[model samples]
Target: MPVVFVARKGLTKLDEKFEADFWAKSLDNVVEVIGNPDCPQAADGLEVGRAYQFQEEQSFSVAKKGDDFAKCMEQLADMVGYHWRMAGADGPGPFRDLFRHPGQFGTIGPVTSAKLAAEFATWDECARAIGKRSFYAWFASMRRMFEYAKTDGGVWLQYE
Candidate 1:
């Protein structure tokens, strides 16, 4: 299985009918509805027969075979504030470990847009210890993640 990332927008009572149609006519085995355990706010109020509307949904694989994953890595490196270069195959890059094991970096969950924005307001001390470039890159990546999360209305991460 490949890691997948999904972007979703929460629906309100007005979209109940559309949510129903989505669940009844569009849901598939490959797409899992993000719920309580992983997204608390999504399941804040429990009710049976209720329809939940997601305004957006996008999936991306994170394995070597996935082009999006590679693109994201390249983009992340370029967007960082640091003037760091990706390490060659023989060397460990600043984000080599993160690229190899994305799940270890963080978990998916509900988060306020402001909170997400605040996360990257400061650079990581550890990354700074590695090098100024590394620190800048780390800061940039965090900002990027926050931006994504804000647009998606939640944190999303999946790994095989």
Candidate 2:
């Protein structure tokens, strides 16, 4: 399955935020991509609506804006063979629920994003092992989302 990770400014009132006007303005930018945000490409088959986490979020294809990295792929495969098992020693990290347990959308607050981003900044093949070229792109995009959220806010994620 192909999933996307979006960085929206507002999360409290999405009903009003994603009005028809918004779609009209962003329709061109709203790419209907079908691929995993973490991986290079997902299964090449029918683009079913249920294949996505949110029908409304089918436009979130920003996570798919990068070339694949070999070191990142190797580390991810060794550390977490499956995305669902992509948690941390402490507890559930990012992308854990997206693969392991379906229907589990998680959030990373700005404070935590800051901490994680800072820590991930130093991640190599030896450390936490997810901050390579493409892997770091995920963190970079997420950090950009946190920028919109600021210190008290963050981004909501969904993958299934």
Candidate 3:
């Protein structure tokens, strides 16, 4: 089964109050993306029906961007894992644990090898169950980050 998850975007600083308003308005469609007025990638992704998260920083550094996205991935994984854990913690009856329960059908058990294998099986059953769009959006985001870097006198891998 494929499941859809939402990640909320957050913005910090801006040039002007109206800049935030314009940025927000521009990114109404995308789910979780935030950025400064100058870096409107988040907003752009959102306006185009993609998901992104906004971040406000002084410069466009590859390491910084990678670290931020790494943190975002961790957060996303934790959120999804915790959601499943909480939803399926209790049981309908004695047989609930033995069989797949309703409402929390795809949630995984403890983090052992068996549990990990089960989770991987669940994820491989359908790309969307774990999050395929997220990978696409993340790749686009990284590409955009590199594009911004290349345009700003920074090092970047050429993508042609």
lDDT of each: 0.42, 0.36, 0.30
Better of 1 and 2 by TM-score: 1
Worst 10 residues of 3 by lDDT: 102-111
Candidate 1 global lDDT: 0.42
How far does residue 108 in candidate 2 sit from its true spot (Å)? 2.1
Candidate 1 residues 41-119, lDDT tens each?
3322323234444455445333434554454455545544322233432344344323333333333333443344454
lDDT of 2 by residue, 38-154 (tens): 321121221211111222221233344223322333344455443324444335444332233221234443444455445344433333244455565644544355455434333
Ranking by TM-score: 1, 2, 3
- Candidate 1 — worst ten consecutive residues by lDDT sum? 39-48
- Residues 35-135 of candidate 3 have per-residue lDDT tens digits of 32322222222222223333322221222344544443443345344332233435332212212221111211111113322433343323334465655
How does model 3 fare in lDDT? 0.30
Model 3 clash tally, residue pairs: 10
lDDT of 2: 0.36
Highest lDDT model number: 1
